[model samples]
Target: MSMRDQAVVVGASGIVGQAVLRAFAETPGWDAVGVSRRLPVNVPLHARHVSVDLTDRDACASVFGAMKDATHLVYAAVNEKPGLVAGWVDRDQMQLNLGMLRNVLEPLQANARGLRHVTLMQGGKAYGIHLDPNLAVPARERWPRHPHDNFYWLQEDYLRERQPHSGWHWTVLRPRLVFGDGLGSNMNPLPAIGVYAALQKARGLPLCYPGGPPRVYQAVDADLIGRACVWAARSIEARNEIFNLANGDEFVWQNVWPVIADAFGMAVGEPQQQHLAETMPPLEAQWAKIVGQHGLQAPPRFREFVGQGFAYADFQLNTGKTGPQPPSLVSTIKIRKAGFTDCMDTEDMLRRWIQRYQELRWLPPRDG
Candidate 1:
């Protein structure tokens, strides 16, 4: 990796994608370029930004064509919107991802001079959703793909099929819930939960846990994921492997609930007997209105609003492998071992997310 051996990040405008771009820019040997449907807000001054429709084969081809010198590719682009979750939504998030992969890989296979590796960000849903009670707690990469997880399975299949035949190294990173600078993110459960909890507290509403009783919930900073991506792209050990990345520590809902409540200044209250669907009907309605008002594009139906209030409920991750050792107990561990030692204070991260939500008018300021 050298200044001349640039790295191209697709979906550079997204939460994970942007973090990946930032990581590439900070790494010593590589220049970073971001390709997306639109130019990302506040792109780093050093990285190049190219706007292109990833769904269009020609457009994707052209973007990669212009990056002829790129030695690494990080596929981070994703269409964000929760409404596409239904089985028949036809948005095809998986297909779109596959198209981008082919568009980049095909050209690289043909013309790249020093193309060495590619890292694609994926999720835990590939293992299965709504895990059975008998299944082990803290799912591992070795777990077979859940038969029902079409999105993850499709993208993963594409990666597995292409890696050996294309002659380039590949790594798939499955990171459970990621939280970081809250400004432009849509998938993170933290920002929404922080905002919802803050608003509920401000309004004197009870704190609600939407999913199954408190299990373990894990998260990693987006930047950490980015660093891991860069490390994987540069290290031969990372090639053709799958890693589960998350905060090294796992906390039961009992633990995380208090942290969020304290950070948002919410009253320490017990879960309401009311189901989330009932208590938060208004919130759901409001979210729909907000989506319509902002004209934000929708994601695959499978992803639509599925994790809303339940972000902290049933989601648990085993971060011992992907996060830090001695276990920061709050941040990702595997990534730490992968050479990313930075950690974002969990409380601080929560507070900042709350503040950003208020600043963006997504949530209102507390009136003492």
Candidate 2:
């Protein structure tokens, strides 16, 4: 579809959602409508904003009912509840995602008019991770579901089952640890670390590395993810397919630690040889002091941060082999061949994020 058509974006207020809206608005021939629980704070006047809770079916139906000429529907909403088990973490997250899909699809299936593509945001968990040692690396779309994967499986199953029957085209994007712009973003771990580290530095405390740093980790900028989503929505080759999204670079946490230190203005001290739990208390105390000094809100306790941070940091995904894998990294040749050629400078992205946090007062000044 040409850029002149209308695109309806669900979860437009979120980091990724907002990025999608920004990207779509810049392209020619596209007018953007955003639907979310609340209107985004600083959207352009040309863009339309609608408020609706995805869990409320009637509200969702009302929102979809108004979009008669929409050419593309992008679902960037996700259901996430930290500290909850797989079964307990709001089946509604998956349900709301599937519900949004079905809500939009029913209209397309009935009218079969303007809908060109429906893109849903999923992540590495859909392909499973090292959580189960039994699983192998470089997980492909064809890999069997891991036993513990409940939420992603349900969503994937619904999409797979419904795509063929629905008239609208469909694509799924699996992005790894998206980091950029929205550091305090609910899903990104780096922001949490950055905030904590910044607070610690402000308090003149040491920034500690937990669990000897994760064995493997990679991240993509939110803008890059947005571009990929838009590209997938427009490209015929992207339909009915799943593609991995990352910065096309991979490194262990050790490689990233120096960057983190530099961002927080901390010395690159010797790596602490300790487990995550033992290292978190002092770091949390340091964070507390920094938060107090800056009058910023205190984050969740050290244990909570450690628990969540470990889960995110320790997980890794193979972003399919296609691009020039930098030295000492695995090949990313498969994804690059699929017309996905976006790369981001992780260090620059981190620096900008740190600056943003400071500007927003989420992080304290160095002397605070």
Candidate 3:
């Protein structure tokens, strides 16, 4: 009989959840089950996929209740209202996210008697970055919670309230500007950047810096966060704690523009400050032709492929201001001190993931 422990990852179609799914799938002694309402383009081949609506309590109970072997849970799912960034502060969005967490946990707790650890995903939103762009440099996990209406707090509170009575412990990870492979993810910018570059190349134009004034920021490789989730699941130090995650470095968008341009086989051009959300959709026919010409695997229809990513990319890049903005840096010292000390250069990480998407056939190959 196979004795591998079960690792069930919810929101398995998201960038964050995909990373977690791969980590658990690749690791020894763990069987990975990915749960998502939508199927991701690149689910790990070793993992099993579960399709169930997390918003429906009965469905989650029916689904999770039968999984008596689930030993670890990674909750990376979130529901955001339409128009992307504007939904960050929406109260209904907050409640929907909270309820989804409740739906999964209540049944999982009742059925998965042997569940040992749970990992929850949060982001810079916990520090008021979504509401106020001028968050202080190097946000720390030690700081008192910011005054806000974030669903992160709601879900965290739910975990806190239940852990004292439950057999399993929980960990929360807050990562900055996550980048990885999840098609139609609400926020990964890879698809947006890839499509933008391809369209520009198709038009014989340079890859313009299509963003606003320069702003410094940090990013975490989704896979790195995934490994950390595995680390937290096994480490006693991670129990009932929160940690901030990053790529251990920082970069400005325009500063890295040349790297991005070269990746797409294009030269850097003038900063165009184009609103990707406003501009990219109208070029779907152009994208369709590029898809067939390059044998790209992404859906030809832009919305099916990108979801809110164009709008998300616009919000991330086109800040529409003339002055310097504060960088959303977060300290990873706590996690390192706790013993998971993995690190990578932000520029190298970007190059690697861009190449990965190309290899995955989600983007066109850089022409010779």
Q: lDDT winner among the candidates?
A: 3
Cα lDDT for residue 64, candidate 1: 71
lDDT of 2 by residue, 1-368 (tens): 33377778788877678778877877776788887775653465678788887777676666677677788888887655564224234566656556666665565445435677788877666644434422455666655555653555666677677667555677777777776443223555664566546744665667765433234555778888878877887787888877777777776666777777777778665544443323344567667665676776434354333334433432321112233322222233555787879888777777776666666665665444
Per residue, candidate 1 scores C-alpha lDDT tens digits across 249-306 of 5545556666666655566675543333234435655554444554433221212433
Candidate 3 lDDT over 249-355, as tens digits, reads 88899999899888878999988887888888899999999999888888898777788999899888854666777776788999999999998888888889889
Against the true structure, whose TM-score is highest?
Answer: 3
| Candidate 1: segments with Cα more than 4 A from true spot | 80-93, 130-134, 165-167, 182-186, 201-212, 273-349, 355-368
Q: Which pairs of residues have clashing backbones in candidate 2?
A: 3-29, 3-30, 4-29, 321-332, 321-333, 321-334, 322-332, 322-333, 322-334, 323-332
lDDT of each: 0.60, 0.63, 0.89
lDDT of 1: 0.60
TM-score of each prediction: 0.74, 0.78, 0.97
| Backbone steric clashes in candidate 2, count | 10
Using TM-score as the measure, name the better of candidate 1 and candidate 2: 2
User: How many steric clashes does model 3 contain?
Assistant: 0
> Which residue runs of candidate 3 sit more than 4 Å off their true CA positions?
none
Error of 1 at 7 (Å): 2.0
Considering summed lDDT, which 10 consecutive residues are worst modelled in model 3? 318-327
